[model samples]
Target: MAVVTRTEPPPRPPRRRRLLYRLRVLRHDPTAALGLILVVLLAYLVVAPLFAVLSDAFRLQYGDEVHAGQQPGEWTGYYLWRVFRSQISRLLFWEPLVNTLVVAVGTTLFALALGGGMAWLVTRTNVPGRRWLAGALVVPYMLPSWTFSLAWLTLFKNERAAGQAGFLQAQGIRTPDWLAYGPLPIVITLGLHYYPFVLLLVGNALRRIDVQLEDSARILGAPRRTVVRRIVIPLMLPALSSAVLLVVGRVLGTFGTPYVLGLPADYRVLSTGLFQSIRDRSTGVASVLATVIVIIGIVIVFTDMRLMREQRRFVTVGGKGAMDRVSDLRRWRWPACALGMAVFAVSVLVPVLTLLLSTVTRIPLNLSTFTLDFWIAEELPGAVGFPHGVLRGPELWEAAWNSLRIVGLASLICAVAGLLVGYVVVRGTAPRIAAFLRQVSFLPYLIPGIAFAAASLSLFAVARGPVPALYGTTFLLILVMAVTHLPYSSRSGIAAMMQLGREPEEAAQIAGASWWQRMRRIIFPIQKGALVTGIVLPFISGLKELSIVVMLTTTGTQLLTTLSIGLVDYGYTQLANGVVLMIALLSFTMTYLTQRLTRSSLASGLGG
Candidate 1:
């Protein structure tokens, strides 16, 4: 025994062996391995482009080399100085930043007010048309964000912005400059488009609230105001915060509406400024503006995270039996119904009707001028860019197919990758890896789409090792869309997976099933609804996306959105509106079909 002990137990496994053993253990854990890979990939994809943009901010870019008196690719602070301290800084940075804040804050408030009221009516009160209102109100979100802007212009546009006066202006209505463009129109358009985010989030939370809590407070002789203030509002804080964050984050990066409405009015927002810089080939300045936008976005996100931390302390759900109670509006039921319908009208019906009217008329809102030429004629004589009817051209069909193929592939990748990411984050053995996956997957959401597009254009325009130059390629478009839209799918996947217990998977493992088999048979079957939700939301979003595809798509790879914008550029208003209506219809039809087939609405998909 002494000799055996003196032999050091026949030499224990080396440190290398222990390390290898640990790696082997990780390899056996598919979740850990997949999570590590996802984290690494997302970090490279998300952080690398950001670094490239940041580097550009300090380097002498192509056009800036002459201005800065430095060679291209050399380090310099000329761009930052120009953006922050130069004579034009107010126009280039400060004013735009102020305008951005105004729009963001205004849109958030307007959306929250309208959306929160509707959510209360539908989820809490005995509103006469609750189901109809619930389904109809979200239609605006399915349409392009610019849909309302275009409608507003159609109704209120004066000679300032272009070709012809709008319907109201044409009728000798003096639409004020403030009403037609700038902050008011931008806020109202964006508010209508984004209010559904609030409705879905707040409505979902309201539905999940236990009636007993409010009832208990009421039984204790608490006033209605107190019950709402102390019980309802506290429970609603998380949803309200989430809704506000979503709306604000969107307002920060949204380019289409601001570009369309603000360009004519000289109303500049950060997104518009970034667009102008990129368009002018001022990469250095563009990077600086982009950096600022990213900083603001990060600040907003951090603030939201802090609020969410506080939200954790106010959990309302308990083990006790919970019932949903609807407040009887009595004489106010019909009025509540009217109010809900009015929201639907402003948010959905009006914009859609205007778009449709514009697409069918040579002069929008003029019945006598309406014609089918834009939609079905053999040729549109004197139409500069679109010489034929929108339906008669192969361009429309081909672009539609490309949009479907490219965005469809991207969405499929998003769904699968998101599910994998969720699994790793929720079930992985390594906590650090999980946390990293969670954060990196969400990184794209904070970067403005235009900035992200600029970054992609810069980074992917060159080849690095195994990855080829992806500029002007459909693959590049697919990749960018997938990465940018990954947040929706990943959030949906994580929510679904968190509700799933590990017992079923453990049972499968005990039965000698492989990791892939367990996931295929047990995990996927249970989370199919979530997978569809993830896929559908991105598909809808990508189909109507204008900002991302605008920068990345070339002539050969035009999407529906790019096509629509091109028509707009060529001043073919009806053709453009036709394309837009098609986009809205496609998005709405797909969303409706998904809901009918899967029994999952946007509310459910978003965990409302």
Candidate 2:
């Protein structure tokens, strides 16, 4: 070798120094700085409470002496053991665990059956009202999950559950115990509510499928059933899993349905049990249940996601433009229309009609009775024995106030934070770290409401080194709402950022402008509409969120969603209905506002 050993080139200063310089520039970059600030703020709001909850579970409280003097702050498996191994274990854990599984499985099956069938019928066969039914089916999904629960109670509640009759009772039918409560009702309600998820997901899948494949099989003498079984189902696996997972995640943390149906039968699911544990001031048991719920959610979600990714292979196979739809059956059109209408009636009209009926009734169960007392009664000091009526009450106002403020604040937090996070993720130079943060933040999405709540509970229980306890504070509510709503926010944020290209910012930088100069002058203005929509969405979702925050706090600190549950629990049906009405109105109004504010921008951003 030639003695001319070239000295190795000195390594450039570590990226850390470069990173600091970049960060300094970012501080000046309004867009970049905005994103970074949001991440920290969100971390504080969302992550801090989680740590507080975790610490609370592990640390000792007033009743530490009850467990034979097991000191507080001492590590013990007592809570876990009690939940899993104690004498009342079945009531606390086993029984509800089964109920959870049954409800989850039932929800998944119903969603698939109803959704998949409709998807197939409309997309492949001569199904009547395919176009109309396709859109109508999505309406229930558009409404919050509890919307159905309220509607279910409004219609099916009998003397056993509500102490008042339902719409059925008014029509001279004693709704059977089976129809009135427990697993069947829970499953039916959740399924009906979520089936639209399946319809949309599977319908999209069906719309992409090639008709030629089916025709080819038929031309080869393959039977209709054979082609469907061999080709359609397999092709549907990905979309099917997506729908299943969505429904499963939804049903897992579902507090409203079980609360409406199961509580009367004394049927317990994890969500209800978690609520009970919290009410009794049993933080440890509640957190543990929350964790298990999260675990179940994770497993289902993991499977669902894997299948979703696997779906990428089923791209539009043919070069032809649009996929063909199943033509309407001319002769059987009436029958097909009837079937579709029946489902639509049950899922949409019936539940809402039931709510309308209940609002005007004095008693929920008995027939041959009617009154508008709940809505317009001015002087029934003892009506429903509540503190107020539907139109007026300190409590009602307080709840409405709480829901609006919290949901509004939380939504704003999520939207702004999500936009920043998304921007950072899409635009950051440190690609790996950005991706890591994005995914980690989204880990909560894979988490079920109960589980994510448990994580927050477990994460925040202790005061830790710097973060303080937040167990019973309003801050905890804000934290959980923000975290639970992160997935939605981030999705919108990332999409919006992607749409707002780098060229404008680059032009600013190229003109000797600092990063902040460009962001203030260029980036934010262009993306403001999209960002606002992101913020607004989380608010909408948070306003109606029930399961995740359900066990996290108690009365006075409760959100409207939780308050509704409490009212129902205390036999305050009218008050609960009032709470629901308030939520629906707020949600609808906000959605309408969002539409008006971003009609043009959103349509462009969404490529509609």
- Separately for all candidates shown, the number of backbone clashes (residues 3 or more apart, or on different chains) is 1, 31
- How would you encode candidate 2's per-residue C-alpha lDDT over 294-333 as one tens digit per residue? 6687788888878777777866576344356455477887
TM-score of each: 0.89, 0.87
lDDT of 2 at 413: 76
lDDT of 2: 0.73
**Residue range with the least summed lDDT across 10 consecutive positions in model 2:** 599-608
lDDT of 1 at 595: 80
lDDT assessment of candidate 1: 0.85
